[model samples]
Target: MHATLTAPSARRTRDRATLVCGIAGLASCMIVIMADFTTATIYERLGLFADTISAMAAGRGAMIMDTALLILVGGIVAIAFGLWRQRLPGWRWRAVIIALLAVAGIIAAIALFNEYGDGDVNDSWTFHYRLVYALGIIFTAVPLLAAHDLKPIDRRLWLGSYALGAAWFVAGPLMFTVPTGWDGLLERVAAGIMLLWLIGASIFLIRQPDGR
Candidate 1:
């Protein structure tokens, strides 16, 4: 006979996994950033900009970059699955979870199909890679928006998600107007904001009591 599924236990496990993966992913990114000893300032070089690193030949930080990205993508996929396992209240909630999963999938794709090498921006893979990255950023906020419905008590969390989304939207266009040196800085800010939102949401999910 098949064993009966325990909803509460399953939910706790999922929540814990989500929290752990979220933190792990962020930590991996930080490690990658620190390992990069390039002369370019953080502001001058976009945070984790694939083109600046990940080259097979000249990539100063390729090993750490690839390792961190693999870890980050794996963690993201785990977190997305964890969120999906939860018993969302309605179809709308389910759709949100699916969207989050899609975002994670896209990230995984980017990690798998990375830039050819440093200064490989003109390549077709690099072009698609950049496009997917932008799309991922745009959709990152959907889970946060759906979180508003999941956890009504935490008005601040959902509001923060909306704010991040708006900021990302505005920042994308504004980056072009800013000095070229600041492009990396702007991209980092947008990415950092999204990561913060994920961290907050993961914490909230962790603290929720069973059956929530």
Candidate 2:
């Protein structure tokens, strides 16, 4: 009887953890949006549509944006751990978890080594731009890898992930081709796609029947 009781208790604990992580994932999305807009207001020359988030972190509101990014890292890490506890089958699922952690690390690095201000050009020596490039690759890879695994859990999420990945493949390259003033807009669109997947995946994890 004690063993059986412990099993249910453990399951409940996992459920609660997944639930908290899901909420954290959602909260992280809100924090980034708020930080971007708040910091944009601090700079007279900053144009939200024309200025990339890196510009916000590199300029007048560096402290605010950097601090928010650190907080965002914690939230993403939580979501990664939440998924890790699920013990999903196959290498694809494992790859998804690894990608999520990599993304969190990249975000933290970006905050640490922010890019040049909006008007400045970043050379090859800048690790910030290199990290951004790496992030774009791995971030998009997560949804594509996880899409197959998510099929058994939720068909809609699986389809959404596949579609999101496909869209990123096209849009990611377009970001660089866009005019100077438009790159920022495209950057945000790319980020929004990733965040949407993160939010949706977290919700599905929270709703899992067994909370595994």
Candidate 3:
């Protein structure tokens, strides 16, 4: 009886942790976007296409974005851990967690390096930074496709993930073809897809019973 009771208690704790991490990840994304818009200067507009959000990590009024990114990284790391605890079978879930952690590492690197301006566009660090961002999103989505097969995950959730993944994948290429001022708009749309998934998944986890 004692052993059974302890198991249920532990499961409950894990469930709570997952819910909290999901909320954290969703909140981090919101805070980052808010900071970027709220702190923008008169000349800068959130709708302008500026490559990565890190483009604003430096210069005047950049501290809010920088700090928000750091918080976002922390939230991502926590979400990865929370997913790992779910122990969904097969290598797919493991791959998902690894991919998220890798992305978190890249985000941290971006925060530390600080993109100044378009001058060093051809620099080695800049190249790697952009490459990693592209790779991270691709890798993250690939694993997510496999997650749909996991029994514990809601079918609707996985379907939503696939839809969002497709949108994000397409949005990146669309950035190059859109009108001059639309780059930022497309970028936010892509990022918002993933953020919506994070928020939905968190709420799902919170509502699920301790087991199953």
**Best TM-score among the predictions, by candidate number:** 2
Higher-lDDT candidate among 1 and 3? 3
Residues 62-156 of candidate 3: C-alpha lDDT, one tens digit per residue: 67777887887887787777677766777767777777777777777667666544565448565654855665465456436545654345677
Each model's Cα RMSD: 5.2, 2.6, 3.2
Leading candidate by lDDT: 2
lDDT of 1 by residue, 61-103 (tens): 4555556656655655555555565556777666666666666
lDDT tens per residue, model 2, 1-212: 89987998898887888888878877887898788888878683567778888867777889988998988888888888888878888999889889999999999988876665344545623666678789889988898998998889778888999999988888877887889887888988887887788887777766764544
* C-alpha RMSD between model 3 and the true structure: 3.2
Worst 10 residues of 1 by lDDT: 49-58
Which lDDT value does model 3 have at 13? 80
115 Cα displacement, candidate 2 (Å): 4.0
Per-model TM against the reference: 0.68, 0.90, 0.80
* Cα lDDT listed for each candidate: 0.56, 0.82, 0.66
The segments of candidate 2 whose C-alpha lies over 4 angstroms from its true place after superposition are 44-46, 117-125, 209-212
Better of 1 and 2 by TM-score: 2
